[model samples]
Target: MRYAQVFYISIYLLAVSFKDVLCIVDPVSLSIGAGVGLGALYGFNFMKDQTYCRVTECCNERSIPGNIGNLRDMLQKRLYGQHIVKQQLISALEAHFNPRISSRKPLVMSFHGTPGTGKNFVAEMIAEALYEKGTKSRFVHKYMGRLDFSVEKNVHIYNQRIYRDVVEGITECPRSLFIFDEVDKMPPGVFESLASLVDYNALPNKLDGSKAIFIFLSNLAGVQISDQLAKMLKNGELRENIKLSAFEQILEKASYNLDGGLKKAGLIEQHVIDHYIPFLPLEKKHVYQCTSAEFMKWERYPHKQVIEAMLQEVITYDRAHGLFSTSGCKTIEKKVATEVWIEKQSV
Candidate 1:
């Protein structure tokens, strides 16, 4: 709209100039000459500025708008924390995409955490950041729980398919991101099988050397629960002879009490407490509650004020519930080893 207005104003100025020239020369000749001059000026300016090519596709060497740097810039803009995750991601990118290196590969990140702890939200932010910066990545959300990729054969098939699609997208567009959501739902084999791909040097390649970012978002709860369930079955506590109603009640109460203890310990945020599920490790008396610092790291990024407020909120909730004392939850602090990735410019 702004450009159109400018163009129209320029044309009007040209017409006024022609009118002035008309007072000195013939109207038809002046108008034609002014029009020709204006056209020539516009063409010269457009070509000289290369304004027509907002997004270049000339060659591999031609600069692409959203490349790896754009993605890094975007994530740095969105995420505010001095966590190892961000730094690790940055270092990995730098190493993998370094032109100095003889070969390059895609970056694969595995995000393992409890559900509702903002894993997917972070992934989306990072992906959108990459997109805004000019990289063409495929955000393939392979939700494990919703889909059937658990069997050994099925897991292999799924990984191969994902690998093929991601590679194709990256080759088509030099920089791309391929996200695999709910990866824990797949059999353990899938994770092990892609170990090479996850690592930098061993990235599988097609005829082209270009690569895409590979990411995995997996909920640790599912794997923990499955392991616990298997153990229970082996111990005969969850045998066929065991009553289903009794098991259900025990599971429910265990979950509630475990979640209550976590809240009482001030090791989890109120929102996390609300969404807590009782996995076996927490309920089976096998796992000790995490320290406040560890909990803060797992539950929230290492933002000082945010972690402090979260602990305070948990303490308040615990007090209201008449749960265990929240005395040790205080003095929770974080000493960051790496600089936070905060973009100085709009990503």
Candidate 2:
């Protein structure tokens, strides 16, 4: 009885208090008009939400990968021969997104590897896995040194442009991703100004920058990586057992001790980078696996003989002492397409 009285009393108050709607517009309908108008507004908001792409504090699960599973599957099935990359990259992403774990700054990582060794490929995979539109997303920024930073002499210009774009991007969307390809080609200090922005500091509007992600790709330590890989292979150790420590020499060399290295630019000195992932040189077998994956991508079964024939024309072991693909799996897709065309014609 008392609950009924309270509920009725609250309804009465609401009905009376909505004078703006009751008295101004529908003076005659006081009891139910307030509710009618309010309910209409609620319906409008619901419809608006359905129609518009509103960004909430959290990412839209429909657009972004809900967990690390998507990335894990993509890497496991697609990225061959780089077990370390698959393991560490997934782990790093998990920790970064885990609320239980606290990161002081944006998740900054540098990819060091030999050319065609899947550095850019891994970066592309990350973008595709993380963003709804992959590399086409407005929130994902990819910069090539030769093109974006063409005027290397004007390093300051590049810095300002980067700063402006990153700040604008962060303001527009906190979950933005920045990829700088061929970091070695850029002037060492090209990104020095961004160090503070990527650190554990409040952004321009007091926004937390920790949700952002930055990836740097380069072949800076290719030689050192290859040398360590060779040593590991020579010692009969599983390449998967090679730890990040194995690439310490490469890091040291690229870490700014020498001029023109990114470390000299402040990322390493300021402790912004979270990891230096090394993409080991792919063996002939790994290349074969890459070729098979490419064939499957084209909806063709990868017969061993067919793939070897395709590789014979384009495979150039003339470089890197025949240890790895001349260009990793970079050109595998094109080569496969050509072979498929020729084979189809012959058939």
Clashing pairs in 1: 66-133, 66-134, 66-135, 137-177
Q: What TM-score, computed on C-alpha atoms, does each candidate reach?
A: 0.40, 0.81
Cα deviation at 340, candidate 1, in Å, is 31
Off by more than 4 A, model 2? 1-48, 54-59, 257-263, 318-321
Q: On residues 9-104, what C-alpha lDDT tens digit does candidate 2 reach at each position?
A: 455455456644664665567646666657755654454344333442224544555347777898889888898798789988888888888776
Q: How close is candidate 1 to the true structure, as a TM-score?
A: 0.40
What does candidate 1's lDDT look like per residue over 1-347, in tens digits? 45754665576566566556654667777767777667656764454235323343322323333345655665554332213345455566566566686544445455543433345656675555445433232333334433645565575675576556655655566555656666544554444334444344444554333345565565544333334444565676633333323233333333223421111221121111112222121221111122333444544345556445544444321222222222222222232111122321334
Best by lDDT: 2
The residue-level lDDT of candidate 1 at 16 comes to 63
> How accurate locally is residue 247 in candidate 2, as Cα lDDT from 0 to 100?
82
Off-target runs (Cα >4 Å) in candidate 1 are 1-82, 133-145, 148-153, 156-160, 188-206, 221-347
Model 1, position 170: C-alpha lDDT score = 51
